[model samples]
Target: MTQSKSIAILIADDDAEDRMLLREAMEENHLPNELFFVENGEELMDFLCHRGNYADKEGYPLPGLILLDLNMPKKDGREALKEIKEDVNLKHIPVVVLTTSKAEEDILKTYDLGVSSFITKPVTFASLVEMIKTLADYWFDLVELPKNPKL
Candidate 1:
């Protein structure tokens, strides 16, 4: 499969275990895209806006896609998602919700907040590997993302 090596992926999840698992899954899938992680929604926003420690754009390049979790400390995914969608500079980047919550309300809410897709976290490691592979294929290989002038 053709991979977009230049496009990085940012994941916002409070759970360290989940982040490690996702990294493992991505490694298993052999995706060429660089993966970055943030433990909270606030950090995610900082990374996106290039504030605080993320001020160096070369060190923390803007992600082409974002995988966000619903529950987080300091600023939940919903709030962060709203802020991202409202910002003209960030709205173009696709944000996907990959959370464990199967609540219909969360699904509807995220979509309304301009999330590209909402996916329930897979239960098994094997399933996660498959999901990561599919996600990489769809976003990097199939989809045509907008060129960020800022980058």
Candidate 2:
């Protein structure tokens, strides 16, 4: 895989406000990566598998990294993470659990399920901006990720 193509950051979150906040945080941090949103785990899976609306590869490019929210209406992040990790085509993408849950069980379970990291959503917007900056720094600048050939 080549790193020349632009890769998006796929985010799965049920809350509209949270998604909006994340987008604003990304903007504040100057994270230029394209961002995609899925309301639930089922939609996230659909997007990754290139099913339904996500079949248009050019419009919905495969994400290099996933920002998953654990709690959702259907199929939650735990199930989505399991499916992504189990799938051969999608397993290479790094998944980071970004959620409001600070539960020990959620953190431990996500890590055990092969999540790259589990981060609790910061309450303040400034903190979120910093978190997004750090995340961008690590994933975009520091690490070399597999680029999607289909893009």
Candidate 3:
């Protein structure tokens, strides 16, 4: 595993338990990352653009990858995704929908919005660990992530 530069993972989820469980799974997978948390799409964008409370670069690192949930407060993932993909500055950052939504329409819409990948969240912690490992392997190890200028 690459150890020099820790990757940043931005996760937007309303559920606190889900966030804790996901963090535990990430720990189990031994994924070297700096995890950023946002409870809603609006916060996610604030973090991304370094606006408002997220303005400090030291406090909010730009995400190397984003794990987005479809349902959120303020702005939903659908709106946030469209905005991100449409903006050249934000579009370069890869987005992966890690959502609980199994709806085909949601899936199709997200893909059309230009998500790099999508995975439905599993029920079990062990399963989540496996999925996280696979995601890490594919995105961090296998795929050549976009080269974004460091903030």
Number of the top-ranking candidate, with lDDT as the measure: 1
CA deviation > 4 Å runs, candidate 1: none
Q: What TM-score does model 2 achieve against the real structure?
A: 0.93
Pairs in clash, predicted candidate 3: none
Q: Worst lDDT window (10 residues) for model 2?
A: 1-10
What's the ranking of the predictions by lDDT, best on top? Answer: 1, 2, 3
After superposition on all C-alphas, the RMSD of every candidate to the true structure, in Å, is: 0.9, 2.5, 1.4
Question: What lDDT score is found at residue 70 in candidate 2?
Answer: 96
Comparing 1 with 2 on TM-score, the higher-scoring candidate is: 1
TM-scores of all predicted structures: 0.97, 0.93, 0.95
Off by over 4 Å in 2: 1-5, 149-151
Candidate 3 RMSD to the real structure: 1.4
Number of backbone collisions per candidate: 0, 0, 0
Model 3: per-residue lDDT, tens digit, 28-140?
Answer: 98776989899999999999999999999887878889999999889999899999999778898889998899999999999999998878999988899999988888888
lDDT of each: 0.93, 0.89, 0.88
